[model samples]
Target: MAANGINSVALPPKDGFASGPLSPGEPAAPGLPLRSPNPLTSKVTSVLSTSYADAEFRDALGLLDERGLANSAETRRQLRLDIQKEVIQSNGDIITEFGRVADQLRRIGTTIDKLNRSYQEMKSHVTAAHKATSSTLDEASNLIAQRQDIEKKQHVLKALREHFVLSEDEEASLTLTSEPVDDRFFAILAKAKKIRTDCEVLLGFEHQTLGLEIMERTSKHLNQAFQKLYRWTQKEFKTLNLENPQINSSVRRALRVLAERPSLFQNCLDFFAEAREQILSDAFYLALTGTSPSGQEDRSVKPIELVAHDTLRYVGDMLAWIHSATVSEREALEILFVSDGNEIAKGIQAGRENDLWRLVTDEADGTPEFDAVKALNELVDRDVSGAARVLRQRVEQVIQTNEDTILAYKLANLLNFYRVTFSKLLGTQSVLLESMSNLETEALRQFRSLMRDHIATLQGEFQHTPSDLGPPDFLQESLKQLTSIMKTYETSLASTGDREADFQPVLAESFDPFISGCENMAKTIKPPSVSVFLINCLLVAKAALAPFDFTQKRVEALQSRVDEHAEKLVASQYAYLRTESGLDTLYDALAPLQATEEDIAKLRTSDALKPDVLIAASQNLDDFLPSALMDAMENLRHLQDSKLTRDITEEATEKFCVDFEHVEEMLISADEAIEQGQTNGHAGSQDGPQSLRALFPRTTGEIRVLLS
Candidate 1:
């Protein structure tokens, strides 16, 4: 039981003693001494001996004894049996332990299942609680929103009752009304009433008027309700002693309605103008005076400067409003212009004479600021040129008569108004130009359609043949007619004037027709003309129509002309080749001919033509076309001499050459091999050379030798 007793002990149990003879104990050894075995070692030894005690073990032991000693065999056998029995018992113990582990695992699984069920129940409760809370929150939010909406409606109703002036009869009528009114209708009625009340307060209604009576009654009630407003305003102004001229002027304007004299109304406007001018002049002085060598305190205020400042501010506002009103309510403005011409004229005259220089320069006798005057002059010149000119002349005359500084300022103010009016006229002119441009675009579209139709008709004429003429003659006539059409297009284009409104459509129609006719004629010809006439006509049309800018429509027409002509030329060339060389039949015979080549070459190689022959035939066909046609093609190519066209043609030609070279090489190689075998002595010999003629004698004999 010592920690390291096994390592310190001897390898074998020596004399069967516990440390050999039990260290002088009382018990004497009988046959062998009892050894104190290490617990771990004894367990291992028992397992090994038990496992080796069977018949299989006996045989192994016998074999070991045969190789060595038989005397020790019995002892070994006994030890092996004991060890084997111990191993069996150990294995049984392991099986029992495993069964206990399995039982424990089952209990754990059962506990886990119960826990999972509880957890699921908890999760369901949590989910339900969350949903309920969310629902409660949503309901609260909805209730709050409803309350807010109600508050807003109440506020609107209160504002309407306080602001709107309704007569006793009208109020009674509203109450008696049984029909249900929507919110939008109520809002509209409220807004209209508010606007009418404001207008009545601002414009001052006559006492005899029904509207005045209602507004007076409403004002009386409002004054009673707002009795503390004056005290509030006084408290607000206490901390700031600055007088707000704008507020004072607004009050004055409202009160002016009570005074019915038109002259008094005019006086009020004059007073407002003077007050506004004073404020503006003060602002200007405040800004510039600090920057001057003379300090801010040195800047002086004058009556003329105040008048000039007010005039400029008023003119600026008037100009802005006029600009907006002209666009939004042009008819209303026109009525105003007719009814209030004298008032407007007088205002303009006063603005022109205003001494703006005194406000800007802070000098009473300073040269009148002509900037506003100049601006007014420019505006008047653009919008109402005649009126502006007359206004300017009158201003100069007035200046000469009154050399009064006030009159000068008034004239300057009037000039500013003229300038604003002129600017509006210029803006109107721009709008007009934009409309004209759109109209031109639409017109051009219509013209293109008309041109395309005419061209289609001309194409028909070129394709159709007369019954009296034979096929060849008919084709020739068609070609002639097409050429004539081209000539007519050229003539029409040449005579068309640059300024003529009808020129574009006429020339487009004429030229487009000729182009289509030429294309159609090409289809009927033996060889395509590839004429430059169509291109020439297009160029001429472009030139004639050049005076009218080269719009998208014209460019499209030109592109169409080029495409049609090119397509027809290619088609005609293909058709001519088919008719002259019977290439169509060759295509059909290709598979059969290939089969025949194999048969003939098998029997006699001499009969089979090489691929070179087919290549030469194709080359000869290409070369056989009329020189006139080639020249025409060259001329047609030259027609695309412009930078844009040159790029297109070069690319097309390069691609065509590459494909043609590939086809030529394939045909040539095949023809050359066949031809060499047929003519050469080495191929003609039966057994001397490999020959297709020998292989396919039947096919070689039937095939006609057409090339030679």
Candidate 2:
């Protein structure tokens, strides 16, 4: 029945009596007591024995048995059943009590929860009330503070009106005063200063600080008013007459007032800036439309001149005013003046490039025209590099248009003018020099091209004619052209006064092809023809360049080029003269005569000598008969003192001598054979001796072999 699953009672002793009586014949156990006997006692005892695990119930049963509750069997049975029913009833009572206690606890928990939620709600309402009360108090405090501040200001205003009084003179002078124009101005200014000091002292400490601040604000306002008047006066002053000296004094007074204010002095710069802007706009318009100040289109006034004149006038007037006003403003005035001048310069440069370029190219010398260019030069700070660039472009254009030597000469003359005219800048700037250089380069390029073409024509003509000799007409004409071209180039250079200019490099380029052509022609044509062609080229080059002092190196180079080919031709000619027929047939022709004396004698009669032997014998002399060979030999003969020519000539002569010796040996054999016949058979051995030397006809010339 308790929470621990047991009754709240002590256990019975092991010897205690059962809850029932003993049977009639059954005795109680030893040391255990039992007296009562009832019919229900038996059942009670049986229940107690069965439920003995409930020790407390068993103990209570023992007490009841000892108290005579069970005496008979019927009574015991009755008691046993009665006790069993009581036990079940007691258990039911305990379970009912536990359910009642749990219900009570749950209801108490619900009541506590409701009380907690109600307390939270009341706290929230109290907080809102407190916030409203605090807000109301803050508003009341703010209202009180504002009322106090209003009262204080009123009191201060009342005090100021009562005590802050000035004299009539002071009151009148306290207002903003214009600077005086006459001798009384200093007296007025002194009165104004006294009025300001007296009012400042009249106000108390707090009011004095406040009054000082107010006065500062008033002073700034008055300063602004004065500056406004000064600007207006300055604007009007531009058209003011100098004849009215009083107006001049007034203007001077205003300027002095403005100058005294260091803070407001910078405002005058704004006026100057406005003037500069107007000047720039006007200048730009004038540059475009060539319009005068009166709005008429005036071509007589050039844009540059207009810009310069306007700028100078503006600067001069502004500076004169500034200097007349105060010396202290010079530094500031000059800065603005120069800045305005720079703006005007930039505006003048706004002229169209074509227009400017036309001015550069114009040859007219009218006063307006000359002044315009000069003014433009001054407007651009006297730097004409920009115009120089235009001139350079013009030179390039001229070069592009012309190609002939005559045209090139004309272009050179034009460039010469540009050079001399612009020579002042030539050393300082490369534009002119570069322009001249480009002209020279272009002229030389044209010359080289012409020379190449002419050389090509000469080469073509040579190919068509198929001759081993010159002077070809095409070569002659080309040489003449080349000479003319060189002369033209020299003249151009000379006119330009470029004393050190060398045209040889261009000539080298032109002559290089000619040299190569001659070399190639020499390979196929006779050396004499090639020699003659090269000689003409060399002579023409020399003659054309002879007059120029700078052309000596070029002339030497040309000679060297010609000489290179000339040497090769001479060696070739030597080889040509040394060409000998094959001696095989010649040897065979003399073989029979070598075999016997009679064989040699037979040949004298029989024309059995092979024609190759005569041809071979005549080979040395035949090599000299061709014009090319003749030329080669002549050249070699002239140069024989030189080692190379001497060696070549000596070698050629040696070859000729060897060839002749072979023929002479054959002749000696034939003569010996004829003498043998004269001794042996006494025949006609002299049809004048009948020798091989006699076999060679007289017209062929007697061949002598000089043994070396």
- Best by TM-score, which number? 2
| Model 2 C-alpha lDDT per residue in residues 627-678, reported as the tens digit of each score | 4323534654433124545555555545544554555666667667657767
Q: TM-scores, in order shown?
A: 0.24, 0.31
lDDT of 1 by residue, 1-708 (tens): 111122122123444434322333456557863554454565566566654546555555555455453445465455445445655787799999999999999999999999999999999999999987997889999999999999999998776565664545434332333322233323433443464567465445455364565567655543422222222223332332123222332122222221222333334333433443343334433332332223445434432223435433433333343343233222322222212343333433343333321122334564453443332222222232222233233334433443322223333333433333433443433322232233334333443554454345445466653222222232343334333433333333232354234334544444445545545554553333333444444554444433343233665676677567655545444444344432333333332333344633432332213334444444454454334234323533444435424443333334333333333333344445557665674655545333322321222111111210
TM-score, model 2 to reference: 0.31
**Would you list the C-alpha lDDT of every candidate in the order shown?**
0.40, 0.49
